[model samples]
Target: MLGDMTASTTPATSARLRTEIPGPASRALQERRAATVAAGVSSVLPVYVTSASGGLLTDADGNTLIDLGSGIAVTNVGHAAPAVVDRVREQAERFAHTCFMVTPYEGYVAVCEALAELTPGDFAKRSALFNSGAEAVENAVKIARVATGRQAVVVFDHAYHGRTNLTMALTARSVPYKHGFGPFAPEVYRVPGSYPYRDGLTGEQAAAAALDRVDKQVGGDSVAAVVIEPIQGEGGFVEPAPGFLPALSRWCSEQGAVFVADEVQTGFCRTGDWFASEHEDVVPDLVATAKGIAGGLPLAAVTGRADLLDAVPPGGLGGTYGGNPIACAAALGAIETLRTRDLAAAARRIGETALPRLRALADETGIIGDVRGRGAMLAAEFVRPGTDEPDPDVTRRVAAACHQAGVVVLTCGTHGNVVRLLPPLVLPDDLLDEGLSVLDRAVRAEAGR
Candidate 1:
């Protein structure tokens, strides 16, 4: 029979490397995964995780590693948060799924209500739940097209929407996400977005250039939606310069196109705000949210202007398990944790603590080209010293060293030379500092090499 698992399985707060990162147990699991799992599915680290709590992930080989990526910004409130777990257990005991489309439930409605309240824009708002961020983005696009009666959609450069067919078309990267997955959806256009680090253009300048392209190529009037990430995620933690997002939003408003903010990675207190749009006081016509929503449960939502969402027919905008009851319960718990714990402030604190350290590291090592991002969603871009040329080799080496030392870091960017950090907001200060120290050592070692 099962005994008390918590006492035996709970990992310590600090990182403890029991063996080499992908120790014998993890290597064995990797062999099994190679046999069974598809090659397409990839993992950042070879260390197979058995359990995770707070800011630590316990691997199969009895190693506890500092969780800097937060499962790619999905665990803002931390892993296995008590409130979320309790709520999930309660909801599961009562009812796991009724298929909201078949028989509607209160949890779904409650989550919608929460989204409407939390998402930016003071006007009357509504939401539709989905299983993933890509689905939410797709639904938002559908709503935009239906409302505006237009076919063309505009996405910015360096955007990373998702992996689905339509989202793959929306995405800008060509190597992995969109390489073999071609013959993409039609009516999607890409324009220049403000990359202050690389372009050296002010936000307004970048917006004007992008708008010029839209007018010349896509025709602003024919555009149904102007979709963008307030802060790009997989394309790098590339936050647009000041005034860029606001200008694009204004242009969309003038052109009769819905401005959609894809906040899949930046929402839910990850960026020191309810949504990244709030940072610029830019209210989007529609917002796509997921990742940190629901404390790691599969929940994504499109929340925005009520009129646009309601324009669709009654039968539109729903899926079989869009808002599973258990997921909804967990979302409620996660939302409560955000509000009561003031995790938004926690995110800000993380920024305050880490940004200065990262900047100092950049100063010490010229290879660290740029350090940017808000709140806990921070990144360090790597380039060859004394030149703008990207050095992905240095980035990979640093990440590998950090991994060996028990800090789980992630690399991203269009050029693949950026190391991004997304530590959970709930992490203790000492553990966060420890993780930073490991990162610092890794970067220093790479620079020396």
Candidate 2:
């Protein structure tokens, strides 16, 4: 187990900087990486991690950085969690892989059962595992199309599904994710989504506006699926207005279209609930989950109404490494941790501790245009004082400063002006407070500039 591991390898909980941000060792690795790795593949912080535990990441230079990003919301139970590590080690000792499709396995079926029990919706549900969020999303689209026999798929503004061809086309952002990657999948449409900060429209009003647009443009009957992130992830932690999700779900049911909640980033108790869609009491016809699932192992799933998934022909949906034994074991252990630790409540506690501090920072620094999110999934949108215009320059400077000061922070948004915080659920209150202090100082310094 993680706790039983040697203490010497795991750095102390607090941030400890022994040298500059990207010290000599990290710089050398960066140079080696630059020579081989693709230029397009970038990192938030260039400090190569040597080890991590709880909420701290130790770099090659021996600097222990406070981890607020949680590897982009993947390590919700925290890095090197005891349960997950132990399970993976035990599974590896038993056997690695025989390919689930070829020989089959109990772990895969067990994970599916767990997912069916945990995911929202009271009706009979089934799941198909995949290797990543993008794969799961693409499969969801396939299932919806097969189930509905329709061609058009509708996504929302400021939404991020994934980077695969179909998902990239479904995505709204064009600069980095979608640029130079087209001739993307056809029949994917984009519609207006509620942005409470920018539009100031109530949930009903936003839903009405979006539905009206769909009626005029694609006609709801033609759309097979309507995919959205309950709380947008890469597009920033943009939580839609309160009634928007339920309204959309109702519209989909009325039109015979599948409502897909892309909870890849907001699932698995990251948003103080098993799923963010539950916050609005909206039960989706389909759901895509990854990131926080499987305790940092490569695993994703498309779980939803049994009818929709069952419509797919046998052997139509599967992959060799979809639910590898080790990954399945990790997921079981991670789920156990989530239940025993009550990490959903832990997420709520994180929000209670961080949101007030962030709101206060927004009050103190006029440049912070908006502070919004739920649970540990939170963000502060930076903008020009007294105006809604995004300030990406300030966002970049603040994130860079936080990195130098030994705090791992991530910036996102279609315009790149939002600083998102996704700290691990296992983060101690003291460590969380310290990370927030660094963020507050960084934002203050940037605001002054």
Candidate 3:
């Protein structure tokens, strides 16, 4: 249904099953990957993808599966989007890498300009590009420290910042991300984050508890920055209750600590807003962004108050490939698509279509403990029937069932009991409906079991 594909095209069908999930061809590739790939680099589904377009992925065995994860919230405009493809091709032909740090280019400056206009601030802003979200987050911390002349950085519970040594200290999870990766960076402190579903507290109440801990344990005045994801990502798509962000931001201002919003997963219209902080009218001093910024290219940025970023020395904040020309080109095209298509509203329509269905499913299935999220980023948390205890086994089964049925779904959360759906904003309504129908039956069967 993207562009003008004929109905007879092999991979153009909304969703098709040519063979069993991970059919023979994919199984063969799996055997090859097992021998060469690292054990820690795991994938949700083992199917080997050959090509992707719009909402469908054509696998090695000719199976066409619907994509619900969007490469972990990348490809938001859609896979191989025409605008992105064109820009990438044009940029590749002209030039690829002339690192922005050595020989600055317009694409890099243009992307920074776009970030200035698009991010949730009307004040003068500056940005430094990076190669990944982790890099951007680390750089944001560096900028905050340099600007505020403080050492302590405060993060929230159930947060997933990154996997780098410094970011691992900033991250709250253990196991796969931070386990055995000590000793981490120093001066990183953790406090409570708002989770209305589990904590059962109003935004102001949760904020007070967190602020109290910050003041008592960390001493807010000593804090360089308070970093948070407007909505938690890998710890589950936990959108904080209303007013929590505003309260923390005000506290940061009063305490002379910078407020940093990690918008890596919630930015670029993925949450029906350019940045999630806009939802609560909260303006952070620095915002780290990535994932959906470049339509699949690896491009990250730390955009914030000009004074904060300007405080850092020139050589103190750059990398060899921080803003690769090709990635910047891709970002420009992706941003253009988001603006022209009004994908922010499209994301809202996606939420409108999917949330009700997910909520109805929650009501029908006792295992579904909660259903929450915004825009195209929604999730269903699984729990043992009649209890709030997490049911990760059932969650895995449901996701496996969806995969076998030619639908790709991803699971997240500290307990691994969440099924988070992040469909591309450009996905056709019929494909989304069909994918949801498959998910519905999968959940019903698994819950019935």
- lDDT, candidate 1, equals 0.92
Model 1 over residues 339-432: C-alpha lDDT tens digits? 9999999999999999999999999988899999999999999999998898999999999988888899999999999999999999999999
Model 3 TM-score? 0.98
In model 2, pairs of residues that clash are none
- Give the per-residue lDDT digits (tens) of candidate 3, residues 120-186: 7799999999989999999999999999899999998889999999999999989889999899999
Candidate 1's displacement at residue 37, Å, is 0.7
lDDT of 2 by residue, 76-100 (tens): 9999999999999999999999999
Model 1 residue 407 lDDT score:
91
Per lDDT, the best of the predicted structures is: 2
Model 2: weakest 10-residue lDDT segment is 1-10
lDDT (C-alpha, whole model) for all candidates? 0.92, 0.93, 0.92
Tell me how far the alpha carbon of residue 279 in candidate 3 is from the true structure, in angstroms, after superposition: 0.7
Clashing pairs in 1: none
Runs of candidate 1 with Cα error greater than 4 angstroms are 1-11
